[model samples]
Target: MPNHTLVNNIDHKDTKIITERSAAYGDDIWFTQTFPAEYRSVQAYYPIFFTKDENTGRFFSVALFGFQQNENLFIKDNRWSVPYIPLTHARTPFLIGEQALMEDGIEKHQRVLFLDEDHPRVNTEQGEPLFLEFGANAPYLESMADMMEVLHHGIEDHNAFIDMLVELELLESFTLDVELNDRSQHQMLGFYTINEDKLAALSSEVIAKLHQNGHLQPIYMTLASQSNVTRLIQLKNAQLGL
Candidate 1:
């Protein structure tokens, strides 16, 4: 496969960074971006993943870039915006489990690895998220579809998450799937309506835990009606005989 180009203008002579700072093993590169203010919930520690394409093969990389602002989750990096999901994490930490488990006769609750205990649970910090991404012998078009699905799951599984929150009492009975002005946005769907009063009373740590586990964006995009990378193939097919 003459490798469909995935990443372009990679300054590292086409070599990009993985899990943050791909400039070089010796180069201290810290990737950062600034996100919109409307999205207040994103944590700085959220890792961004990427992929590279060459004539012989394709590769993927995961990065945990830093944000200049202490208050937002967005990055200043031109190539690594929060929204782009790389094919590297086709199998993300966004695991779907049947139920909780026990370890050595004691309850073994598997916290989503994204959680950062050092941060004030809710104060304003998400600990350095563990970044792990790998490559495989696959093309971007197919690989990206699977990666996007995982991202979609992370965003749209709101109701299922709300159910989990109720089971955990992270919120005193929450509702979800609320849709917004745009059908693609939340207002059109349901909402995780917390008992407003009870919700306010909860601790920040408890709240942060919920945000970390929500996987909000991943699921939303996965199930979203608008995003369609497949359209590219269709357009190309039309020009095939040209």
Candidate 2:
């Protein structure tokens, strides 16, 4: 279970978060949730794919890190091998939470930063400090706040983006079967990708709508990112010494 609490300097003034990237800090993840705004950067190094939540059936984008569950091929020597790490993974132990606020005598809910006290990254000493002398936020904490803000808006837009894809019936089931340099075979199931054929069949008017609404670029980016699967396979083969 997670013990998450609102990050207050008064209560957690001496707390420090592990800035190091390692499996101990929960960095051994095969994929992380991503958004359309990040496809350009994320697609460059990792294969972008869509997955659904079995409980809610909500579609979400992810950046792949490995071929199998809980395998992060990018981690070596306690470091992330890739230059670009997904924001969702980098923001571990801290997430945006809703809180009530009073403004102009009106009560409203707003997103606030919350830290998981029980997470492996949280500790009384070592790594980045959450606060400085006189209880001011540390530089890393300020960056996390900015990241949470961007993630909040990005996720809000992702819902509409998914809705548009559903309306257009552009999502289609996909399966990836691969044989590494070794004799081992792997099959990936229960994932979805953009239907290029259906995308090409869209009428000009609809295509223009997607283009004007900033969805077209991400669609193409996703398509382009499929090429990076070859890179991922190579990484896997290297890991297997195949």
Candidate 3:
């Protein structure tokens, strides 16, 4: 469970967040949520795939880091090897929360910053400080807030993009079977990818609409990212000494 609390300078002036990438800090994730705006940078380093939420049955995009659970191939020597870290992963130990406030006799909802008090990265003695001596947000905290803002809107865009893809019947289920150099086999299931056949068959008018909506490029980027699976397999083989 997460001990979530609203961040206030008075109560958390000495709080610090460890920004290092390491499994000890809970960075050993196999995949993380991503959005179309990040597809260009993400496609270069990881394979982009769509995954469905079990309870809601809604699809969302993810960038795969490894073949199995808790196996993040990007973490080496306590560092994330990729140049571009997904926003969801970059904003760690911090989350955006909505607070209802009354402004001029009107009730309004505002996004507020919340931190996980029990997270390993949270401490009072080390890493980036959350607040300065005068009780103002530190530079690191500002950056995290900005990241959270982007993530908040990006998720909305991601959902809309997925809905468009679904309406167009452009997503297809896929299963990947991999045989490592040492003959070790791994199978990936319950993932979806862009259906190139369906996309190619779409009318030019539909393609124009996708282009106008700024989603066409990301669609191609997702397809191009499939090549990274081979790179991922090589990384896995290297790990196995195969």
Candidate 4:
């Protein structure tokens, strides 16, 4: 239930948003939506995986932060411990949306900036201002627009990439069973990952096709990112005082 509205300087002239990384601002997320374009950075610090939306049955890429629900090991003392926060996580309270516009007696849809009025980060004072004295966008606001642009295109590209993986029979459901330092057992389910066996078994022709389509590098990056799972385990253990 996001209270999204097309951004306008007049309607939101005094709006200021906190840009700090803190759990109070809702940064304690277990995972954030991710895409192939961000795999290189995201994979370096977090394990990349996929989950299917129960309502839509659509697949989404994600960067993992913790092993279980509602747990984010990265948040310690209300500060994010990681350097490379995913764009999707950083771009809170703002999103790209479409609006109908009329031009020359014809109607068309145009992309517009939307902000969540109900987000905790949004406030009227003591943060980055959305506009200047004369209705000009603030510097930080401009940066947010750039980030939103990248995210908008990245989401489109990622949807196609996921489709390609599914078409090639490269996606498989995986279950992770973990034993904590205290000998506590945990099991993670309902997530998907690329099948390395299927990927390696592909013919040269198919590999060439994947390469031509700009999907080959990200595929390898996702595979290499599995190594980061051990890092996640270490973080969890540290959080547990092990």
Candidate 5:
């Protein structure tokens, strides 16, 4: 379980975070949540798919890195092999939390930064420092704050986009079957993808609405990203040396 606590410079001035990408630091995830704003970059290197949360049953988008669980093929030589990492993956050890603040004598909740003390990347020595010598945020911390801000808005957009997709009945469940060069086979299930037939069958007015609302491109981007599945198979074959 993650031990999350509010971050303050005074109490955590000496905190450092390991920025390296490696399985040792828990980068061995097969997929991570993504949003439409990131689809352009994510589609270039990953296959974007929709999945439902087991607990909430809410649908969300993800960038697939591998065919199975805990099999991240993008980690190479203790580093991310790709140029762009999904913001959800890049913003580690830090997450957005709510803080109550007084505004005109009324208490209001505001988004604040929270740190996961139990994360493997967190430490007091080595790696990127979170605070400078004089209780100010370091460059790495600043960047993380910016990332969290982007993620906050991205999640909002993601929710609205998913609602639109669900309303239009554009999502469909899918199962992916993979065969490795060593003759080993695997099946990936419980994921969803866009229903192209439904999308095409949508009325022109509906299509125009999607385009006007800035979702049509991402829908197409998700479709385009499926091609990267072939690349993933190649990587798996290379990893298996067959």
Candidate 6:
């Protein structure tokens, strides 16, 4: 799984919607200041972590399903919120309210949730935490197989997923208008230029390998709305000069 690095400053915008993996537990909380009506996707199924602990052989997992946002500006109970707001959307366990925190001294940051140290159940033989995790959207701009490669393993070996291109026939291409986090935006950042020469050079040995492995396609798309995710991938692939 892709390892995560601390993003010290918010202005840098270094973080992308990524799939992270680790053997130890972690506490990473992200908050949103603006909630547009069209963007309820803030509550997408957050990718959880799976860590194996040899000390206790127990599988433990937790998911949040509710949200509570506090907008009361007058009292301590509502200090964490912006102020004078109504809780319009709270479908899942995503609580939008501001919670209390200890006063250390100088630097301060938001605290979302704290996980327990020990597992409740331990297997008779060994003590370990069996971890299992699932994420829907394949949040990468490259090819689908390439996307999985980077997510599961930090580096990708292109030779593995190359066969997917055989089944990936010619699909019409189009231009997209992308709006950046800043007011600036770009339209048609690039185009999907497929190499017919590469397709024609397929060898019999390569064909046999592809037949054995079977064809694969993307399971999930990652656009604001997934409707244009495939198209976006093609655009990115073209821009990359692949």
- Look at candidate 1 and tell me the lDDT of residue 18: 27
Task: Give the TM-scores of the predictions, in the order they appear.
Answer: 0.21, 0.97, 0.97, 0.95, 0.97, 0.20
Model 4 per-residue lDDT tens digits across residues 190-226? 9999998999899999999999999999999888888
Ranked by TM-score, the better of candidates 3 and 4 is: 3
What digit string (tens of lDDT, one per residue) describes model 6 on residues 49-137?
11122476322111111111221111222122222211211111112222355677655545231112132221223222122123222
For model 2, give the RMSD to the true fold: 1.0
> Which residues of candidate 1, in runs, are more than 4 Å off?
1-44, 47-73, 81-138, 155-158, 172-242
RMSD of each candidate?
Answer: 19.1, 1.0, 0.9, 1.4, 1.0, 21.3
Task: Give the alpha-carbon lDDT of every model.
Answer: 0.31, 0.90, 0.93, 0.89, 0.94, 0.26
lDDT of 1 by residue, 109-213 (tens): 542212121222111123222221333222422343444445445434433553554564433212223222233322111112223465456678876775686
Per-residue C-alpha lDDT of model 5 across residues 1-242, encoded as one tens digit per residue: 99998888987899999999999998999999999999999999999999989999999999999988899999999899989999998998899988899999999998899999999999998899989999989999899999999999999999999999999999999899988888999899999999999999999999999999999999999999999999999999999887
**Which ranges in model 3 have alpha carbons more than 4 Å from their true place?**
none
Q: Which stretches of candidate 2 lie above 4 Å from their native place?
A: none
Tell me how candidate 1 scores on lDDT.
Answer: 0.31
Clashes within 3 Å, all models in order = 45, 0, 0, 0, 0, 20
Models ranked on lDDT: 5, 3, 2, 4, 1, 6
Alpha-carbon error at 96 in model 4, in Å? 1.0
The residue-level lDDT of candidate 6 at 124 comes to 23
State residue 132's C-alpha deviation in candidate 1, in Å.
Answer: 29
Q: Assess candidate 6 and give its lDDT.
A: 0.26
Question: What digit string (tens of lDDT, one per residue) describes model 3 on residues 14-35?
Answer: 9998888898999999999899
- So what's the TM-score on candidate 6? 0.20
